[model samples]
Each structure stands twice: as C-alpha cells, then as structure tokens.
Target: MTSTPSSTHFLTIKNTFISTKNHIHTSLNTPLHAPNSPIWTASEIAESVHGKLLKWGPPGTICTDTRALQPNTNQWFFAITGQHFDAHDFISPQLYGKGCVGVIGNRVCEGWDNGFVQVEGNGNVNTVDSLINMASYARNKRFNGVLVGVTGSVGKSTTKSMIALALESLGVNVFKSYGNWNNRVGVALSLIGMDRNVDIAVLEMGMSGKGEILELARMVRPEIRVVLNVGASHLENLGSLEEVAMAKSEIFREAKLGDICVFNADDPLVSTLPVPHGVRKVFFGRRMGCDVRLVAAETADGGLGVRVVLEKEKEMVKFVIPSPGLHLALDACAAAAVATLFGLSLAQVGKSFSKFVPVHMRSELQVARNGIKIVNDAYNANPLSTRAAIDLLQSIACDGNRVAILGDMLELGSIEIESHEKILSHCCDSNIDLVGLAGNRFLIAAKNMNLNRVKNIVHANDAKILAQKIVKRLKFNDVVLVKGSRAMQMEKVVDAIKAMSIHIPP
Candidate 1:
C-alpha cells in the first residue's frame, strides 16, 4: 500500500526542484524573467512547443492575439485559428516592425524567412498543445522551484492561494495562479510567466470535458498534485459524477513513482479512485482516518475558525479561514496538507491560514455605501458551491433581513431544471428573509414547482433586472448574498446595491 511520505523534513524553506536534463544556462546577471537574456533562443523554442524554425529571430514575450499586441515590444505571436475566428489573419510582414519577433503557427503565410516558426501540429488541439509544450519546457528547464498543481470542481483558486500563503509565511518565495486562471491558456501563461527566483509554483488545473486534465497533467509534470473534490461542476460537458472523478484523476498521469498525490478523502467519488502503484497518497478531509482531518469549524471574528489534525505529527492544528462556509474551510484544510508535505509544521500552516483572504468577488463580505453587508460570491457557481454560499448567508447574524440575490447556474445541461429547483428550495427553507432570482433555468424551476410551497421569492429576466428588483427591496444593515454562474454576472446586483442612494428608496 502506498502511504504519505514521511519526508516532510526534506522539503522545507529554500528547498526547490531543479531539473537536470535540458538545463538552461543563461547570463548570471540576467534572470529568466528579464527579457534581456532570452530564456530560449528561436531554435530552442521551436523544438520546445513542437514547431519548426521556418524563420528565426530573437525571442520576446508570447502572444496569442494580435489585438493585444504591443508594438515595438519584441513579442512573439501565436496565430491561433478557431471555427469562427483566425488569429493568423493579422500576422503580416509589418508585424515585426510592430515589435513581433516572429510568428509561431502551422502556416508559413508571409514567407519562410520572415521570422516564422512553422508549428508542427494542426487544428486547435495541436495549437494549444504547442503552448502547453512551451509551459512544459519552462517547468523542466527553468530556475529551481517545487511545482504544485491544484484541481477540482470548485475551490481551486482559493486553495491555491492558501498553499502559497502558508509557504510564504515560512519565508519561502512562492509563485501562484491568480483568479480563475486554471484553464489551458491560463495555466500555460502562468507557468511560462513565473518569476525565476521563486521557491514554489502553485497552479490550478480546470477542465471542461474529458481528457483535458490528462493533457494538462502531461505538460505540468508537477511534483505535488492536489485533487480537491468532485461535484456537479462541468456536468453539462462531462455528463456524470463518475466521469468527472475519472477526468480529475488524470492529474496523476504525470505522477511518477515517488510523486505526492493529495486528495480529499471525504469525497465518496474522490476517495475511491484508483491510484498508481508507487505514488505517495495524502488524504485531507473531515473523515477520521484522513491524513489531514478537519476537527471542527465555528464562527469567529467575522470569519471561520477551524481545527486540523495532521496524522504524521500527531498534532492538532487550529486556524481561521478568512471566509465563511464549511467548503472554504475544507479548501484551507487541503492546503494545510500540501503545506506540510513541503515540511511546514501543522502550526506553521495554521498561522498562515489565519492570514489568507478570499479572492475578490468570491465569498467576500463587503459593506455597501448604505452600510449593508453583501456576500459577493459572483465569481462562478454550480449546484454544490451555490448551495454552500446560501448556507453561509443564512448562518451570519443579520441586523435585518438576510436577502439572497441568485442567478442561473449555467452549464448544467439536462439537470439544469432540477439543480435550480433544489437551490431555490434550499433558499426558501433556510432563514433567508427574501430571495431575488434571475435566468431562464431558475424561472422554469419556479414555474414548474408549486409556488404555494416556495415563498419570499421574486423573479427577473437577467442580472440587470434582478439587480433592480433586489435594490428596491434593500433595507439598511441587511446582509445580502449575490451569486450565480459566470455567464450570469451576478456581481451587477452587488454593484447596483453599492450605487443606491444614501437612504432607502422608500
């Protein structure tokens, strides 16, 4: 049976991973982050992203869109084409004068010697693979840093930040992913653009369908891989929970014999995946047998205070998560597991946890212009995460009504109706005083279900209309929660409330 490595002592501060093969040796005075010393020559990058050097020039920054191209900046261009749009159309001989060092693509449009790197693969997959390869090359050859990959249906960005904070608290220089930059393009850019002096790089891997995580895993080749949980997220593309679990498990594809795999053992789906023979398994959850277990979570100082148990050290760790909700606390617990693998004591990780803050527009408690508290969890949402946010809103002690402004949870596909119905039902049953809903799915759910059973509900066409409806009912000192899918743009409701008149419109 594979077990969690007791090698924590070996991964402390200043400890980093330095790949020996394909090692890049550059100027001592110039770091890889500095453009003066090219991290990769034209020939080197051609081989890196799996392209041919039809034309060659000095390397610069990487560009996928020409519109965002800065002239006279000496940047490289990637002319990616999709079914509706083609980025290659803007690439002309004049682009070089506009600061393009060269064009990286499969086509040789402006001629062979005009600084074009003939991309080897065809179609969108290959084009993206080429970028992934560039990230892979950078990870394998760049300055020393322990690479950490984070993935799950939710909590990726929050957990990624937590791990970085824990490491940084110990005086470890860390590189981390920002916002929701977990997709292919975002992940590639983050890895390639990292500061070369960091001790650790924490990245998030998000997938929309099958095989996406596997491809990202193949390229990232992280030393420590974190699988947070499997839920109803991306169900429209993946179809079922088992498929989501299977897809998430692909992150272990690059897990070599001794690599560390950290997972949420409390999840029925996540805890049951088949692990490769020799990889070390570290489990974090509220379950008793978990390697990193959550002992308790309670309300404290406008946030959540929790306790974690680290099995190896036989220590009980206590900390405060800067956000409310049990889900966010669990994410921080998972981060503690990852932090310990890097030789941080449970106490050390807990201290850092107390200082961690949620990303903007994500479970943040903000006081509006009229002193109303708004839970701005509008970053993105699914059935599971949306429900959690609802629970959070109900738990807070409110001076006035607890209002919930919710929009559609997108991409649920066939289960869209049922998902919205449950969320609406959850709101009605909770202590929430009023509810304002938007989106076709929620409307359908409200209409399909007996309105006699569901009360305190109002409907709107979209976020804008919902914002108007919510602001009209707004009261002084009321605690409101705004959340929905990314497409729903529920933040508009929060903004609308902030823009309200000094006194209630009544």
Candidate 2:
C-alpha cells in the first residue's frame, strides 16, 4: 500500500490561515480581504510553488520584460517561455551585473552562478504554473480591495482604464491593470503585486480561445465581473460569433452567490448570459430598465456629454468623458455602474468620469499646429470598433477632407475578406474622402469592391509605404483616422504623418 506523505501545514500568517494540507483556499464565507493569507516571505513563496530554494534573497517585486529590468533591486524575474521564443535565452550576464533579487523558472540561464537567488522547480517547470499559483497567492493574500475582472471582444483596455481613473479621482486607492496586460500571465502579474493599501484592483482579462477566461477567472475569482460585449474580435481563433460569446461568458466562471456581475444590456450576446442564482446583476447601456442606462449622449465642448440614469437608485448622473463616441459613453455607463456599487453616489461617479482620458493609440485626439486633426486609434481594431471610428470621423466638424487609413482587421479566420470588404464599403458609404488601405486582406477586398462609386483610394503592403502615399496627398487641417489590428503596426503611419511635413496637396 502506498503511504500518504505525512504533512500537516497550518500557516497562521497575520492571523490568516494560508495553507492546509499543501493546498491554498479562500473562503466565500469569510469577508473580502479577510487576511486569510498575508504577504508571503521568500521561503513561503518557494514552498507554495514547490520550488527548491537553491539560494535565498530578500523579498522583491516581479518583472517580465527584460528591457525594464533595473539594477541592484529586490526584483524577481519570471522568465516566461513563449511559443516562438524563450525569455531565458535573453537573460544575459549584463542583467546579472546590474543585479536583481532572483529569477523564477525551470530554465537555468548563463547567470545562475552570479550570486543571485533562484527559485527553480523540477518536472519540466517553465514558471507558468508557478506564476499562476502566485496569481492564486495574489488572490488569497493581502489588502482590502474588490477585485474587478473586465472582459470583452473590444474596448477592454479603455473600459478597464475608465473604471480605475474614475475610482482614483474619487480618492480611492486603486490598482489598475497595466496597458493591455490581459493574458493569463498578464492577469497574474497585475494581481501578484497588489498593494495592500489598494481599495479596488481593476484587472482586464483577455482570451483568444475557449477555456482561457475560465482558467483565469478560476484563479483570481474577482468579486465584481464586468462583461462588456461580444464581437468578432477573435473569430479566427474561436471560429464564430456564438463561439466567441461562449469564450467570453467564461469570465463568469468563478462568480458566486454574493458576487456582482455586470454586462452591457444593449449587446445582443452579452446581455443574455445566465447568471448564478443569488448573484447581483448590474446592467448598463442605452436599453430601457438598465441599472445604468445612457439617457442622452452627444458631442459637447469637444468631448462627450453623456447623461446616465440609474433606475434602481432613482437618480440621474451627467458626466463628460474626454473623448467622443456613443461607444465610449456606453463604456462610461459600465464604469458608472461599477462605481455605484462601491457606495459612490451618482453625482460622484459623474464627476470622476470627467477626468477619464482615452488610452494612448486608442482614440487620442491630437491637433497639429496647422490644425490637422489625427484620431490616433492605431492600437487594435475589430468590426465593431471600426464602425464606431468611421462614424466618429464623419461626424467630426472637418473643414478639410476626411482620410481613413484603415488596416486589416486580423483574426477573422474565414470571414477575413467579408469583414474587410464591409469596412471598405462602410467607408465608401460615408463621406470619407480618401480611404487608405494596408494588409493583403484589404488589398483583396479593394479589388472585389466596385470602385466606380468609391472615393479616392490607395494601397500599400504595410504602414511605412502607406504613410508615404498619405503624406503626398495629405493637406493641412485634413482629419485623419489611423486604425488597424494589433499586428499591423499602423502607429507607424501616425508617427510618419506627425514627423514628416505634410505637402500642401497641389
């Protein structure tokens, strides 16, 4: 008979039970941030991950990017092994020379002998599990803050930022998810270093396929879960819109009886998801009877003036987001719903939103000295967001031509051609004067479209060449909307436009 290893571990850390029988657990019966698990020491971190501490260093922070690694600090590096490249390969002698607290991973790089501590585990361990376990550790340990998980097909980064900024403006100690850091590793990283003084931890959760959000949600178990919308953002990986909806619905996996779940009532897909019994539902959008409903929205004073009414509170909140678009106003509604839950009044929520700025490369409104307006939305794009950007470009009071430098909406899988064609067609239907195109999909779609009715159009293999074309025809005060999928690097066009002198188009 195989004998069970005799191990009984009860870590009473700060009057919080951390581990029992080699397992860590959080009690829903216990209050939020009950201190069931306090901050972990170097030894505790090693023990939890089943890593052997060949050497010990002082407690430190965690870093993933090698370029950001600083010298002589208590920073532990999580060398993530990605698909195409191994981060361990980049861990150089110079990195050790600069000095860090330690490294965590199965790989033993060249600097192993360089006197820094290493938490290396056995069994083909490449640090992802340990990192995830640390994510769990983040969930269990420290501080008093409501962990809010945000997920959707688009606008996740903006929505996550909006919530954080609004709460922070109101003097809440907020810990926001770093820009677009929503993957499994990114999510873990956001939570693992959660400061104890934080009142709200707003984390963005992203996934490309099935089981991704569920896996992440199971680990963090956020108390407030916000599902914005479902669209064709990742149709290539997941197959269809229904499948995409299913993938996003996984964000609610860990939601329990007392948790709060938020959704966009106007979204056809996100509004209909099943909620666990006893969990509170907070809906936001233009739809009637929504907890937070968009009462009226319009361009006001160069920004967005949005009036939102909360049915349950029987109050109206008016706010101004430092950006334009009904979509962004809807995002504000989502943020307002979240703020209301934290005991913030409707008026306070409104005031806090006034400080919200668009994320860089998302919808940054920039004006050149010559009055050339650039809507730098080059971060990432899908069909839903592209339509909004198009509408916004047409609605802007432009004294000059409207040029839309559109890139390929990637990850659409089979519908790549259809999606691209529809966007080009939408541009044609609009008053956009010049429709600049990039990527093979758009090139193909441009060929398929009937050009007799379409406006002036140009094509380029990539962003660099496309910028040349636009600059040649570019005019002062011409409003340009630069947008593309993440892989397209369309910011190059925006940068090129800003750097190069725009020709006085003869």
Candidate 3:
C-alpha cells in the first residue's frame, strides 16, 4: 500500500490516500497519529492547544472552516473563546461521529460531544494570549535547523522570501513563514503546522513594542538573525523611533555562541548594534565600510535600475533588480549577504536576486499606453520608507513634474502629527510639484506645512476623493507615486488613474 511520504510531514498530501468499504485513511501507508481528516479527539486537540495555553485545559469541539472543510479534505480547526465571537455559533452537525473528538467552545455548545472550557472574562484577550504562548511552545521543540529571523520597518517579507528562495535553489528543503505572517499568532501557525521535511525555516518576526521581539526570539532561537533597517513605521505604538530600533534589535538577544547577525550597513541604527563576539556579524549596503556595497546604480529605460555591487568575493557585477527605489536595492544587498552565509555562491545568490519580486503595493510599476507612469507603493508605510518613495519619485527628471499622492501612516503612537509634518517637509524638499494627501493626519500636516499656499499641492481628507481629484490633475509623462500604509488603500487612486483615458504627452 502506498502511503503519504509521512502524514506528519505533509503540508497538503496527494494520491496516497486510500478509502475502502470499511475504512478510510488519508495516507494508506503512514500511521495516523492524530485522526482522520477534519476530525480529531477533543483530548488530542486540547493537547495541541495545551502546548499554547501551558495549562491542561480540556478542549472544546473541533470545527473546520466550511470553505476548507470537506469530506476527505485533510484539515481541522479549533475554536477558542475570545473577547469577541464565540466558537459556538459556527459548529456544524456533521462533525460528531464514531471517531469524532470533542467540539471546541467557551460554554456548552450544542451539536458538540467532546469538551468545553469556561473562560471567565474577555475571551479574545485570553485566546490571543494563549495562542501566543502556544506558538512560542511549538517553535521551541526539535529546533534542529538554522532559523533565520528577519524584521524591518519594511522589506521583511521580501527579504525573508529571498532567503527562502536562495536556500531552496541550493537544494535546501526550506520552510518559510508565508506572506505577512510575522506577528505572534502568524508565527505560531507556521510552527504548529510545520512540515517535518523543512531543512531550514525562514521566519519573519515583527513587533510594535519594547519586548515583542524578545518574545519571538525566545520562540525561534534563530541561529541567524537579520534585522533590516529599522524605521518609524509604528512610532505611536512604539513610543519613539529609537525605541523601534531597540525593539527590532531584540532579535539578537537570544542568539547563541555561534549565531550570525546580519544588518544593513547604511542604516545607522542597525549598523551600531553591539553584536556578541563569538557570533558572526555581516553588513550590506552602498556605504564604503560595508562588507557589501552597491558600487554603481543607473536607472534604465523603465523605472528599474541596473545596479552593480561588491560582495565578499565578487568585486563588481551588474544586475537588474525590477525596482526603482534605492531601498529595494539595499534589501537585495541584505538578502545577498544573508544567502552568502548560508553557503550559496555569489552567482547563485546574485541570480536569486533577479528572481526576487516585490510584494504587491510596495513600489509596483505600471505604465499606460500613452506613457503615464505610476509607482504603486501603498502596502505599508513609515517615515523612512515614505521618504525613500519620495526620493524615487523626485528622480523622474528635470522635465517630468513629479507628483506624490500620500496618505496617513497609522499606528505612530503620539508622534503621528509631527511625523506627518516631517513627511510633508520631505515632499517639499524633494521638489515634488504636485502633492495630494489623504486622511486626517496628512490633511492636518499638509495644512500645517502651508501646502495650501503652494499652488501645486492639494489635500483631501478621504483617499477615494483624493484619488479621483488627483486622477483629473495628472498630465502625460507626469510620474505619480501612490503610497501609504495598507489601511490607507492608496491603490484605489492607482485604479482611478487607470480608469481614465491616458493623455499623451506633447
């Protein structure tokens, strides 16, 4: 009988599943330690949940999401009580059977036979806390492979993807935390359901507080920790920009004797970290003293630039990164430096850099038939990345009227207003002729900057209104940059622009 490679190691298994008149097994040959697909014992599930909860609390019923839950569809889910919704509402009747475990819920939920846990107050708070603890627990077990933890005000996801790609290209069975799964809950999910086949797991850890990184660091115990340039993304929650740096640096706190620390040489905060002696330290950027330096950069026909850089062994080699922002260039350098320590050659590393693509809403490029250029960089925003985007927009040349469509950056604790003001000042300094800003903070900052007096500047409190207004104002060959935090949804503006007919430049 053919079995799954190993039921425990399969992220999603295929044809090895077997079904007979009397029995059904997802993997005919493999041992089923948990149970059938979409069903598990209440006790078994509680054991998993216990790993997160740290207490021997009885589990409630197990319910899989209807979308992913199907006959022979190999997955199950546990619902824990939180401050918000109760798991009781979503339970279906088909879950209870001969092999059925218990239902997971806060109180005695109907259509459930297995178990229930009584949460006294604020279920969501407890649920999230328990989940965080469980995530920490699961990651600490059998941590054999090197765990690379990467975080930055920006580029953490992209950098982690590059590390994973470079490693996988070298025949390493790499497991990477998917998308923006950098928070505590996301990290927990990655580790809990990790496939045993993963040779190296690249994790992205993001924090908005003083001790959050330490918590993640303790969980992963990374052998190689990469802290990308820390900037003021969540300044409000994090108190100050310096505090943000400290929080990001906490990734290095749990490094062992032989761990490696990778950092951006150009970012002063990241470069100045007091790394431990036995652990290796590597730096990458355009700075002269850095171990890796971008020797030359020339913007090509498209917004993307052909950049040449010097690595540890390679002196200078030109490569085309499909991005215009210098920040992205620095991210590529950082990824290269990281891959080098992982035993990848310069060619292998450099080749993977080209293969690296930007995630959506982070400086994505689009051109109209009539030659209007738009830089869509509205994924996530902080002051530093905003400035970087502005710099790229300002480089549109002596002829093109560089336009910046900006939105307010969220989660900047108390310094929100001042930070927005600073961004307005940077836009002015960059000589952007036309500026359109959205959200209350940006509107206030724009007014404070006296942008109303500047004939070219326009401020709108809402993003949709601003996008429509700016679409009408854009001219041919005008380079417009659409950027803000994801919450701002500045992509709508890019959409509005595309919706209009292009006006050809004379």
> Which one is best on TM-score?
2
Model 3 residue 261 CA deviation in Å: 1.7
The segments of candidate 1 whose C-alpha lies over 4 angstroms from its true place after superposition are: 1-4, 7-40, 54-56, 66-72, 92-99, 106-115, 121-126, 302-312, 452-455, 504-506
C-alpha RMSD values across all candidates: 5.1, 9.0, 9.3
Top lDDT prediction, candidate number: 1
lDDT pick, better of 1 and 2: 1
lDDT of 2 by residue, 86-164 (tens): 7777676566655455666665565465323344554455677778877786677654456788999888888888777
Model 1, position 352, has a per-residue lDDT of: 80
User: In terms of lDDT, which candidate is stronger, 2 or 3?
Assistant: 2
Model 1 whole-model lDDT (C-alpha atoms): 0.76
- What is the C-alpha lDDT profile of model 3 across 32-136, one tens digit per residue? 231221223334444545522212323222332333333433333445545665555665556443223333334344544434433323344345555554455
Better of 1 and 3 by lDDT: 1
Can you write out model 1's per-residue Cα lDDT over 1-506, one digit (the tens) per residue? 22554444334422443222333322111112334223456886798777788777886776666665566677777776566876777867767666677788777454534577877765444476677778888778874667899999889988988888887755555677656778887788777766566667788999989999988887777878889999888889989989899999999866876578888888888877777877778888878777777777776654332333334347887666656676777887898888877667888888888776777777888888797888899989999899999988877778789998888998777798999989888987896899888888888898888752455787888999888877888788789999988989888898999988757555
Ranking according to TM-score, highest score first: 2, 1, 3
Task: State in Å the error of residue 302, model 3.
Answer: 3.8
